[model samples]
Target: MRKRFLVLILLSLPLGSFSQDINFELDFSAVYWAPKSNDTIRISVGNNGRYIFTDSEEVAKSFGSITRRFQPAGGKENADLKLLFDLKTIFMLMEVKIGQNTVLANVDLNQFMKKGKSIDSATVRKMSATPTALKIENNGKKYKLYGVAPDNKPDDLIYMAFNEKYPVDYDTYFSKLMTSATGELFSIDIPSGLLVHVEDSKGEIILELLSIKKKKQKGSANIQLKLE
Candidate 1:
């Protein structure tokens, strides 16, 4: 049997002062080969300030639902949804049903790679060992976020080192980080029956035993996001 994959890309505009809320719409398609047949999948991602929704259609069945939220390593909230075939792979179809409208799309995994050639192995290792840190100034307060050894303390010098590696205006970098984090929260879903330990930059686990519950006939799950 051939494996299937789906990828959804959601983009949000830069935040600015406004009464109206910001939302996102995304759609994509993909074709795959199974042992007995070729199949196609469609996916969509939507956010209307308050909540994020993802819808997928595979063959003909539809899956639509709200996402699960997680507290990241910086005391920030994150959300995600996943359809898995096993321990290592995710399913490729999703769908959303609004009051009177439905949105859909498919994912082409190969298309994601088309954006650029592969990175070198050494570069990949370096990135994994040291994810770029971001210093954000929101509402006149500055905060730093990054990955580090599980035992190290978070401080200003850490922020400065990250700043030197990625040279950009702090505000601009902060905005991008917020947008990216929001997108990840919308798409990735935490699995049930597993323990997800969320932490702060100081390596302190703040949230544990997050639960996922599926809404009745809704094709989605609601999460009881709790912090310790």
Candidate 2:
């Protein structure tokens, strides 16, 4: 009788209760829609929520010559720029290391954002004013990052979008991740925590959530796509 009771209790417990706190991973890559060149860039985001930037501007410039003119000043060569933020606000710039280099990220802000004491609608507006950046738009099926024209009107400068077939519970996390990813790449802000749909040929640089991998402890995963 007791043995039967023990088995019943185990069966009644919630599913996945054991593996909730273990190793997890998500891998995202950006690839050109064109099959001719078919160049792909891989970005690795760690469990601690750190998004590392490898190459953004140069890749954008390569897509089209027009992007060269919108380069953010300072010749900021972010070969391996590991920029960390609060995940809530852009002002909370945390210092993290990339190799042996000490990242003076605040200095980079001068070229991209208008520094202020508090984060408000006004500050966000100023930050979004940079021409090189693209704002992310989240529709139900996909995400779009569009740009504004020089005269403050909508322009077809950069039209990029990618899919968001991720889990619903992780929606918040993905939104913030896309925000930092875009910011580090093109100095933009994604107010809505939703993302991805890469399209068109307007010389815009953005990332798409290529793949997501999850696992438990004592397990690891690395997804790689070699360029030809």
Candidate 2 regions with alpha-carbon error over 4 angstroms: 1-82, 91-112, 115-151, 167-196, 200-209, 214-228
lDDT (tens digit, per residue) of candidate 2 on 179-223: 343332222333332124444445544444444334222222122
The 10 consecutive residues of candidate 2 with the worst lDDT sum are: 2-11
Candidate 1 residue lDDT tens string, 7-116 = 13322112112212222332211122222233333222112111223322343232211321112244422222333111011112233333322322223222232222
Error of 2 at 219 (Å): 17
Q: How accurate is candidate 2 locally (lDDT)?
A: 0.32
- What's the true lDDT of residue 205 in model 1? 40
The TM-score leader among the candidates is 2
Name model 1 segments beyond 4 Å from true: 1-92, 113-116, 122-193, 203-207, 212-228
